[model samples]
Target: MTPALDIAHSVSGQPWHWRGGVIDGLSGSFQPDDLVTGLLLSRGCARDEIDAYRTPTIRSFMPDPSIFRDMDQAAERIVAAIRAQEKVTIFGDYDVDGATSAALLIRLLRGLGLDAGYYIPDRLMEGYGPSGEALVKLAEQGSSLIVTVDCGAQAFEALQQAKDAGVDVIVVDHHKCAAELPVAHSLVNPNRLDEEDGAAHGHLAAVGVAFLLGAAIVRRLRDTGYFDSRAEPKLIELLDIVALGTVADVAALHGLNRAFVAQGLKVMAAQRNIGINALLEASRLDRAPIASDLGFRLGPRINAGGRVGKSDLGVRLLTTEDPEEAKAIAAELEHFNEERRAIEAAVTEQALELGKGQDNRSVALVSGKGWHPGVIGIVASRLKEKLHRPAIVIALDADGIGKGSGRSVAGADLGSAVLAAKDTGLLMAGGGHPMAAGLTVAEDKIDALAEFLDARMADDVTRARGERALQLDAVVAPGGVTPALVEALEEGGPYGMGWPAPRIATGPVRVIKADIVGTDHVRAIVAGEDGRSLKTIAFRAADTPVGQAMLSAGTTRKLWVAGRAKIDDWGPRPAAELHLEDAAWAD
Candidate 1:
């Protein structure tokens, strides 16, 4: 709804891109509050221009997974292994992917009444993946088939150890594959070298692949009589877990992942699982589930266990059938998550200081002594988003062994960069997708690793930055705020990494109310000339770039706002609110 001008307003000099897109297809106009959000729906199916925004689905395949090579084979092998009712152990990572993968596999196994046990390496002790110690032990415990969920692509030595101990290992992973994959009974990884599938799907976190494995396994079980004695465990039931792992682990939310998330949210809203329900209740989420709720609320709590507490925290919480046991583990994770936030704040400050001076080269490599290895990945991602550059955050131990995680910008090749560092013998072990990866470097070699990465990634960084542009959607006067607009976005969502929630642009408004909310958040209201306005809150902005921008802005300058519309029920009266982003003053 375009507002008629009652009085003369600020003259627009340089016009911005309307950042517009088709809305519900029938109405080709870009509504002001529906800019970035409309683009997300239009980018996908035409039919979804309306409903998908409210309920996004992976079932609709916008993301072409043909880019990944081994997805099909990896999916197929998992089916074959699961149908036989052979003893299985899911070896997963300590973080989100590993936790989700283990959860997915263990759930499937338990549903089928098969021997299923999950093993997550202790972050403080055993390191990552299936270690020699765990592998040998699994062999001794009479495990016939060992299915490594997230971490097996890097376990070359341990797989051989398992094989020698008379154990057949099946690796269902999504990581940078080595020249020689572990000599497992069968390695099912989208990142495997010899595969013929597409690379686009390789963006899936291990949990996503494990979901595919779950799908294939259920199919194979049907071909046999696995369900003859009992109804087969519904693969759809696992989608909730799949979606949780996929979104929480920050995988691309395109293609099947879209379906996973879209469907998963529905399942999650039903709160079928005792563990998921406990997690939701412990997190204090009032309304039903949304994709962001999983990322902001649930994912972090699950990861808290591995980051600062015991690695088994997530595994136990997800797998325990007992309500009291699940509640206990979930509660512990909630406490750990609180502690993790404090640790992250301190670690991020130290990293920012260390990264202050570096210039020109694309990657930001920050090393800190005695940092927690479990939380390195999130810190790397934070640094990358802050500087708009690739970043590798390393945690160095007293023993001079540095464990690190990396987050990459859109254009930079992070997987290759990690590989190059490893090639030069600076890293002990490391690999990942372009957007995110993990590795371990010797403490003394941190400088050499950073320098090595700069050389390899400098050109790509420059190329990526040179293509600067902003696609702003519809322009709206401050008078157009309404509850109806927020409701419309629901039909277009189920958003994730590849697909983002829409952001509306508005301007010619003055700051009405602005205050800091959480540990690092700013809450403010921007009012237009017509006495109409929107509420906005920015998270993690306290003492940061965005926080300072909102807190210190004077009322004299008219500022434009871009953010999502949310319904805040905090106070007795419920009303709509705005989440602030970038702003520019009207000249």
Candidate 2:
């Protein structure tokens, strides 16, 4: 548990720790400088599992779909609908994960000649999850079956309403579930309390679960000779959206999820899906997107539609076949994204100002009337990042109903706390996974909810904050931070969430020059004792402690910079630069 370096504190006021101990007994075939091997070992891969971890694949990581509690039943029902040509609708949430999950199923059903319709509730009017009214209306609209993805684990009344309306509902979700299950035709969630065999994959996004159902349906069709006259749909092609949702949802990247991204990126590069192709072009990303692009670029654009514009635009863009329609939708989404950015900036500023007074509380909970509920989740994320603690942002309507979203730091279970609050009558509606959650509460009870969360999560927040050391995968000299090193390190990735990209500490060097660049980024040049200069930039840090330290170093003070080494592809020649995260004085 000792700090990676001899120094105990960095300029950011946190220590640096090695991600893992010395890696030994790796295959003899690997050279001493094989960074991928080292990265795998440091990330908890066993020596014998290096080969499997090196190239994660669905064939290697995918489990039996039938092992899930209701997977088979759900798939069978969907296939039966396809056979009977029954009207079907996909009910999804108003986020990237929901959009992608609904789109994946729609595309699959389209390939099977079903042409299933979709429903995404307006964020402002309908809020999160499928309501009883929405479900019963869909049933009354002649739809005989509905599939709710990325939500519905807590829709006790909604499911009951659907049942009473005589329409079957299948829940394909990954949210944490309470012990008392809702009344659905089938509920397929790996995180369900009764899920034993499939619970190992509790990290899957809703799209991941839908992908399993797709496979199961395909398998069932093949067994029943349903594909004897028609060509079976290639389910692998759908991984593109699966990858998009899994990353956008910020699901952990390991095991099956890693394979989904690693392979999905390849499928995306093929540009078979017209909707995705238009999205890539609209985002002005000329090259195939990496994991980061999905989260930062395309995902946000899709989310923008749900946040500020029409909620169905994302599902439409992802499922459309008309090139002109795709182009127009993509362009509209881009505009919405810009509008969303402006609104988010304003809300984030206000939330941060309000959060300034909550340093003593275990959670930073802020609320304001007339704030856009669509942007509360993003604002919560920003607050959590700034405060380094769990944060919740609630937008209260004129009627005193509050729509709240929360983001949690590592080791703090925000979703469970919200669920506990709902059980105790503090929340009217709430449920989510560990990292993020959504809820509804009365404006009058906001203070009580805050106090309940403070008491429940105080110990967890303290322990997580006390262990706030930056983790480094390796240490390299300034000259060693080259394009080759970046390439070597990438063999261990498609990194996101749980499977973190490797970070290296490079320095014991003096700052040669430093200046504020675009927006609030700090760009600097530093030279090691060997006289090799390296480029580094700390994004959105010009006003922060690390940025201030780098700006004041002024070629005299020596320090170590820790960050991910990435190749600067925009340059004439590929060179490496550090996306600096933290720094510590060496002398």
Candidate 3:
């Protein structure tokens, strides 16, 4: 049945919408009395699946590794290398996903009595994927077997070159693949067009795919009696790395991916990996990291290595066993992160200025002659968020060739649009997922590319913007929001990306006090009809209607505050605070 969309006019003048899911099999078998279970039911979880979701064990959600196409082949090749003691090399992307994928395999192989080397393509000098020259060079350096992670899915020419050079290469990637496959020893990707059971897990990041490959390798070795004399490495311990990579890559946290993060957090909290521990210390996070910490803190430091510093730093940091070396690498990454932030800020300012002038265009296209290529992606993301449309930020080099990165708004397939541009000869090279993409283009063709995107993607962009709606989970009184409630809601979590944190609306509250806090945040305290007052903060919303309305609201005005409930431990007692997202007046 088509459910009616409940819509409300928020104080920000944007339409707030909620579409409640019918509790499947709710024949009065079990009734949820708490916020957590109610949140689960609202998000489409069946009563039977609640227990599994609450715990989210990999054993419960993990699919058999053999379900993927070429899984057997990929596993067999790795096992052969381990048996023969052949030198193996890992080629990984510079991003966190690639770094962790390489680190995971290197750690696994090292445990099995093989030392594997790794290579990361420089974002500036080498660009995105493996190059034919790099592959041939690695083969020349005595790497008998090479595995490419988070990349090589689009390396048709490079893979062919590797094959011609007599190097056996296995591709473990999650990027969108073309109809024509790359020539590799075995290409293992759930996103492959012809994949069956694996195709359902297309949302997996490359690191998730690597973990699956790890499982396959272990299973194959176990069957061959390779572990008869040796103690099997505990594969579960590596979930910490898996969790970091998966969350950093912004993979949707649902199904298997959620299980990975949920279990991975438990593994991470143990501080088993020296490098991870060092990173925690460097980031000033004394406690165990949450899902948001992976994305904001540690993830950015690792990404800083790829963006502005040495591309190999991330893999080195992740693989290092020496605590001192790990600490040094973490510190270096911290420095790089600072540099990246400065660079990103400058580029974002320029990109925003250029993007603001592009109000008439459906997609913002901003390019500069000397903007650093490393920071363009971040700038694109900022522009996309501000413009509420797809945004492309291009960095033009001396030869008039430009490297561009783009971010897409929800419901827009910017990556597909970029791919179409490549196919139309407007781009030199381009590919990505729906939300993000990268491309190379001639400086002179920027205008043509912009025109092409505007004309071709106009309808999609418009439809996407019009369909935007905020989904709220439940409504609760101010007194109902408590530390216990927040703790309970977390059971269904490790929430991120597609699996969002539950947002609740608390209504019939009068503003007790409101003021601007920090540079651009609105902070307020409101008293509900129950005379319970709660603190609320709306980040980066000072100038927006939501913030302005809250900040200037009269004491007599009663409003409903909608946002995620979070645990704030600033005081002696841990209390639940509302991270205000939106609000509406109530009678």
Candidate 4:
């Protein structure tokens, strides 16, 4: 029932437990820790259906779009716009998910010989989500039908204004919604109050929902023989955009989402999209991109556009056709990403200092005047990671108004708490998913808002913090760590926010070499009793207990290294290396 060596406590003082894995009934064809079986058990794969999950496909996981309440209405309206040649616009949020969702619709409409424009509100200027003023303005500009992607879920007033202005709107979003729906012609959201079968997919990102809508539109158009004269646009080709948006939004990678990313990576590797190709080059990615690359590399650059530069730049890049224009946009986004780092660093430093003085509160609420509104979300994320609890960072403007973004730990539903605060008239406006949220508040109400959130969510935060655990997938020996094993682990991917990459413990190894790398990284080569050795690297942990122990321990001492397996291509031949997260000395 217990591990051979107790690595229950990490250097940060969290207990680690092996995930719910069974060594028996594994078909007796492989070891308990074999890549395939480990992945299957970690994800709770059924014995008979293991093969199906091994290679997820849209055909296997795609649900009927009409299962959603307003899917048919939304699809039919879109088709009508295509037939009437009416001007349509896609209204989107400012993050990666919104940008990609807008781009998906624009591109889909374009392929059908329809000219579609897009509107992405400025992060600092417009705050978040669709506004009634912006919607009415678009209607005045001749857009008969407007589709809001990744937003409009909580735009009760904005949607009502748009409806009153005589403009038809379709909402394709996946944010959490209240019981009373927004006033729109059709709202295609899984989180809708009356949702039935579609509610099972409540975890989808806005782009994923948009992609479902795209499927419905294509199907309806096909039934009407709209594609007989013109070639049917291959919706599969757009999965690359879907993959990027889904991963960047931190959507759970289960069921259909895993299929999307798994197949989308293939589409991305084809280098078909000029914009994506340009972005890859800008990121210095010479090889094919993977799922993690979406979150760590491409997502950041796309987000940088909304964070520190022009908000529309991301959508423009994703929907562009000109190679030169793509390159220009990609380079601009790259520059913004660099700028974002500097701004985020400054804001994070200030927020951490403020957080240190608020240890008495369940949630860390830090605010500063003149902070960049664009970087508040990133700063909040950093604070949550460092503090291991709910965090809210606010950027106060000169006119006594503050725009705040918040992130929460797993068991804490900060989104619901924020919504509750907004309902109590404590916040001017606020909405978000369970783990993340955004709000606008009067400067003077900052303390009141903090107290309201803490009081409302105190018990939940405490329970969540108490249940946090480090889950390991399997165990391996030093000799078992090889490039072959690393490649085999791919069957369990594309790992992300909800669907984590597997972590393994390779133990009873003596440290042959350990040293500090560039900046604050710890690098070491550990060997087992069989004399098999492998390299490991702990990033940004040179001063931490784990890194210090690795560097200072004598060669005679043995330890278990815990981390994810990575393919190391630094040598002529590929090797497996561990991105070390934690290590414990062997008893």
TM-score top scorer: 2
Against the reference, the lDDT scores of all candidates come to 0.73, 0.91, 0.86, 0.87
Worst lDDT run of 10 residues, candidate 4, spans 23-32
> C-alpha displacement of 326 in model 1, angstroms?
1.7
Model 1 alpha-carbon drift over 4 Å, by segment: 1-86, 198-200, 542-549
lDDT of 1 by residue, 297-324 (tens): 9999999999899887887887778999
TM-score of each: 0.89, 0.96, 0.92, 0.94
TM-score of 1: 0.89
lDDT of 2 by residue, 1-587 (tens): 11246547898889888887532211212244467878888888889978888988899999999999999989999999999999999999989999999999999999998999999999999999999999999999999999999999999999999999999999999999999999999999999999999999999999999999999999999999988999999999999999999999999998999999999999999998888899899899877688989998999999999999999999999998899999999999999999998899889889989999999999999999989998999999989988999999999999999999999999999999999999999999999889999999999999999999999999999999999999988777777788777777788888999989988887788999999988789999999887989999999898888999899998888999989988886778889999999998988
Model 3 agreement with the true structure over 1-587: per-residue lDDT tens digits: 11232346787666766536332211212234444677676666789998887778899989999999999999999999999999999999999999999999999999888899999999999999899999999999998899999999888889999999999999999877777788998999998889998999998999999999999999999999999999898889999999999999888888899999988989999989999998989998876688988998899999999999999999998899999999999999999999998888888878888888898898999999889998898899888877878999999999999999998877788877887888789988888887788899999899999999998889999998887667776566777777766766676688888878877777678889999887578999988776988888998788777798798777888887789888885767778899998888775
Strongest candidate by lDDT? 2
In the order shown, the candidates' Cα RMSDs to the true structure are: 4.3, 2.8, 3.8, 2.8
* Candidate 2 vs. true structure, TM-score: 0.96
Question: For model 2, what is the C-alpha lDDT against the true structure?
Answer: 0.91
Q: What is candidate 1's CA lDDT for residue 542?
A: 71
- Candidate 3: where is the Cα deviation over 4 Å? 1-7, 19-33, 510-512, 529-531, 554-556, 569-573
Give per-residue CA lDDT, model 4, range 290-369, as digits (tens).
Answer: 89899989999999999889999999999999999999999999999999998988888899889988777889999999
Better of 3 and 4 by TM-score: 4
